[model samples]
Target: MKKLLKRIKALIRKIFQQFSSTLEPSPPPSYHSPETWIPPIPPVPSFAPQWENGLVLVCSQCTVEQFAGSSHRINRSITATEELQNWLKSRLKFDGLWGKYRVISTSCLGICPQSRVVVVLRNHLVGQQCLLVDPQSDREILYSYIKQMNQ
Candidate 1:
């Protein structure tokens, strides 16, 4: 039993020595000094297509709960934005009007309503108008407002 314990202790020491011998030494602190490093050049930024009239930024993070009878479901913000985009495309298709407007699904605009997504409209005339849009009810009103601004 004593001889077995002695062998185990010797094996552990040999394993530790092998592990230590396999490790490479860390570099000296002076090797990573700031004066020896060169700064990397940053790339120029590219922008989206320039719109003539305006653009709409819809919040993709907004989630709204809808209840029907006994069951309820959450409405995704993306579908609402897509619906708004389609509506805009259909209504504003007159003599380059559609080309001037853009609908973009963006991150949260920070005005997250409990039952609606935040829609920000920007044009040369109005500058900017932030509104909470209910997809089912506010489509017509929103279209009219955007039309008024473009004209």
Candidate 2:
């Protein structure tokens, strides 16, 4: 037992020595001399709600999205269209955007159909084109469609 323990200790020492031999020497700690250390000035950040390529608009007036704004005739599904709109807005990083895109809500879109639809204004090869969204679209479908539109 003593001989076995001795062999194990030797083996461990050999392994550690091999590891240490392969390792390079670390550099000395930096003192950060005053002339060498120049602090960077924070940049002035500019933000805009509208993307350079596309615009996403949710239909707040869609009867399926909200019961208060909608009538009994708009009860088409259990899930509201507002969830899809919020998801789209989050994916587009348009949260708290009250500048440009906020004004184009569904109530202002003028599409008063019962279907829960969204509007996508995309900059295609021929300038800006409007897209009519499908009511049956879920979060994944809406995300994919928005991604495609942006591309």
Candidate 3:
């Protein structure tokens, strides 16, 4: 009886060893770093922007609360910003100020108005001016201001 129990225990131990070895996880794969990781030059050209003096940055992340009867809950800033950009582009080309200024839609510029979009005008002569503009009613005013600043 003792020899039989010992043989059974040894058989169970052998089976457990085989099962555990099959279930054991494999070793992790090795990694090698590339030798030519850094490039010799920048990927793109480094030419300066065509804008001569004025740079207008319009915030594209702002939002205004909608009126009580509107279906949408809020108004997005990009719609207003793009509208203003198109308006300015057409007018600037007509006035021959297209090369003198550039309008870019940018992320939040740190000055966040609850009901308006923030616009930053960087000019060589007048310096920097930050304006809170309502796109629906302030496009002409903003354009006039930009013209004033460039002058």
Candidate 4:
């Protein structure tokens, strides 16, 4: 039993040594070559809403700054903009109203007090109107509003 255990330990050590010796150090990643460093694909351009089209949701004064005990406290600062963009994309897709309107994600709409975000609907009839939306507001409300404006 002792011999067998010794042999197994010896074999394991040999195997590890062989593996370590044979392993070639990986070269540092090169960023100079475009082929080697693939840039992420840009987001698809949002469909322009037909005349009197879609709503634009903006996140104004979005930063690491947070109000105490507010819902925005846990929100990630960097992706706030991306989150708004993606939200518009998903809302448009889920509502089955993708091509019918435009959903824009614009920077700082100048309404800083309204939590972390502000939504605006721009169409021929409504011109430009600001919407005060709760973080939990149903996206369908915006869609329904747009539909009504179209009629």
Model 1: CA > 4 A from native: 1-50, 64-78, 94-96
lDDT tens digits, residues 64-130, model 3?
2223235856554446667777787788899999988998888877777766778899887788999
Candidate 4 lDDT at 48 equals: 43
Best by lDDT: 3
Clashing pairs in 2: none
Residue 57, candidate 3: alpha-carbon lDDT: 87
TM-score of structure candidate 3: 0.58
List the candidates' TM-scores in order: 0.56, 0.41, 0.58, 0.47
Candidate 3: stretches off by over 4 Å: 1-49, 64-78
> Order of candidates by lDDT, top first?
3, 1, 4, 2
Clashes of each: 0, 0, 0, 2
Backbone-clash count (model 4) = 2
Model 4, span 1-151: residue lDDT tens: 9999999999999999999988966554675564476556889878644634645655644432234347645635545545555666677678676666676666666666444456777766668778755444545575566566555
Model 1: per-residue lDDT, tens digit, 1-151? 9999999999999999999988956544665666565555799998766576898777766642222221656444446666776777777775457767887778877776766768889887779999888876888888877777777
Which ten contiguous residues of candidate 1 have the minimum total lDDT?
63-72
Clashing residue pairs in candidate 1, if any? Answer: none
